[model samples]
Target: MAQWLAAQPKTIVVQPTTLCPMDCTYCYLLERHLKQEMTPQVASAVADGIGPSWEPVEVVWHGGEPLAVGLTRFVELLQPFESLRQARRVRHKVQTGGGRPITDAWCDVFEQYEIGVGVSIDGPRELNHHRVDRGGRPMFDRTIAGIETLKRRCIPFTVLAVVSQDGTGQAAQVLDFMRDLGTSWVGFNIEAKEGANSDGQTPSIDHARQFWRDTFEWCRRNNDVTVREVSNLLGFLGLTQERRDADSQHDPIPTIAWNGDVVLLSPELLGVRSVTYDDFVAGNVLEDDLSAIVQRSDELLYVQEFTNALETCKQTCEFFSFCQGAHAGDRFFEHGTFAVTETDHCRNSVQAPVLALAELLQAKGSR
Candidate 1:
């Protein structure tokens, strides 16, 4: 238990609020409309809970929409980490949908705190039609305007684009759009069937393979922009000669919700409920010590099952070393159990890209 608790994650994700302005079609946030904000007391509790560490800790501010808390309230939320930041390195990050109103005041906070911003957008206007508001109005222009503001303020940000079936064929166009937006780095997230919205079919593995291949070619042509998925796949395959240590399946990444409830692993698991696992809450940080909660988390039935399933994958699956098994939230949502192995998510996200890139590299080598 001591060895298990020692492997703490470097990043901790905090959900400051659960109030999003837009209602995307495939959003997994079940309680997005709850309109709850994390109190400064809870924020301070969470910060103190983390305590001191040798390495720099990153607090990722994520939510239904983190910006929904407004600039003034958001600063109050960050106040708890000030002591830690002064003592040692404590990096701040915020992940937002980027469709909300972006004011100079918000930019001032970003610049002052040096927060790493990650904005969610699905590419061109046509591709982003699914990420609309409650009135079904397209948010492409609004999101772009917010991104443009970030650019004007000289605050560097990364773009997170969800690749749906509609936009899979337009990889080049998507690359061009992000490039024109002056985005230095872009991450691609497949439209996953998780949480409340499980209507859409997972993209076929073949289609995903082709999409990644095409996107890889585009990235090769434009050396200025970095595509995260391609780079990660290449690194995993040893094609880029940048191999790193495989992520530990048991490492605890504490994701604290707005109410101070701590969820290990995926932050998406915060609001989701399961019949067997209940709310998947290890314990409330406000009540229990963070380290104690993380240590006790290993005793959770679902966590035990999740760890067992990962061990099985490591023993059986060929790609185990690369992915270290699929994410716990993905496995639970797609398979309805953490003890299951191999999901549509694994096929498209993990296997397809590696196979596609391997084939491409093999052909080039043969030539």
Candidate 2:
């Protein structure tokens, strides 16, 4: 058990800049860029805080649009961390919106330093309307061009698509677009109903549920490519035979924002407001000791509350153990508590999937 724990390395997320050019409706970070550039001193401090101990650290550059910092300044920020990566202490990654053009020089930096890259795009032309520029013009062409550049250069990347009401009805079309893009893997993230655009345009929970069902069935029928949303579901379906103990190395998945704040579990948690903390950031890795902050974060208090809710759920819901409670941000946004489950997630992410699977089983039995 101890050996298993030792094998996993800690992950560090570094946000070099948060200046974003695009103005997506659902982007919570749109209001977060009051100030969004990191100094050399802060970047160096981040490098020193993580230190040489955490054997396999992953530094993820996430931002309003990570590449908005420009390729030159980005290189300056990465130079210090790149040296550490070369020494076998850390891994690197960058997440971008792909709304901007990519340069050969940028690709060279990515090829030289990171293990993988992730881009945000809904799908082909028609499905990506909501992610437009400030002038209300569709930027899908530019995004597609950026993706083509990556594919042309053989740079390994993943596409993250937000499944919305429109997307739900057009899962097949979205999948077709992905297949054409030659996307090796795709993550179909559900649009959160509580953030920037939630007030006027949140998708119905029923629509979300249908979308998950349709998307999952699509993945099962077309098994040639990797679909991350279905992969997670399959794990829940007991389809995978592999089993291991809990002592396995559990690296802290860090999501560092442009201002140096660290969020746990997922990067999506950043800017997600909580009732108690009102802010999701546990600490700034550059200014605070990473280990100490992780230990003392107010974020954990919310996690504990959520865990307590799960315990209560197990007593009531038959599928409690198999379910993922609402994402912390969603819970806080909808219910005003991290401990409670949002009706949307319960209906969409959990209840809907379970019921759909049950119906399929019953129909098969009757036949």
Best by TM-score: 1
Model 2 bad stretches (over 4 Å): 1-11, 30-35, 51-55, 87-89, 239-252, 265-275, 298-301, 324-326
Which regions of candidate 1 are displaced past 4 Å? 1-6, 237-251
Q: Estimate TM-scores for all models.
A: 0.94, 0.84
| Tens digit per residue, CA lDDT, model 2, 1-367 | 2221122337666766666777777776634444477777667767766644566677777776878788878877887776788887877778888756876777898888765788888987888887888687888988888878888899978888887677878877788788888777888766665655555344676676677667767776886557775675567676333331111232446666766777764455666674676566778866796666655543376655655564565556665545534355566556666566545656666666666666666867999
RMSD of each: 2.2, 3.9
Q: Candidate 1's error at 164, in angstroms?
A: 0.7
Clashing pairs for predicted structure model 2, backbone only: none
Candidate 1, backbone clash total: 0
Query: lDDT of model 1 at residue 197?
Result: 70
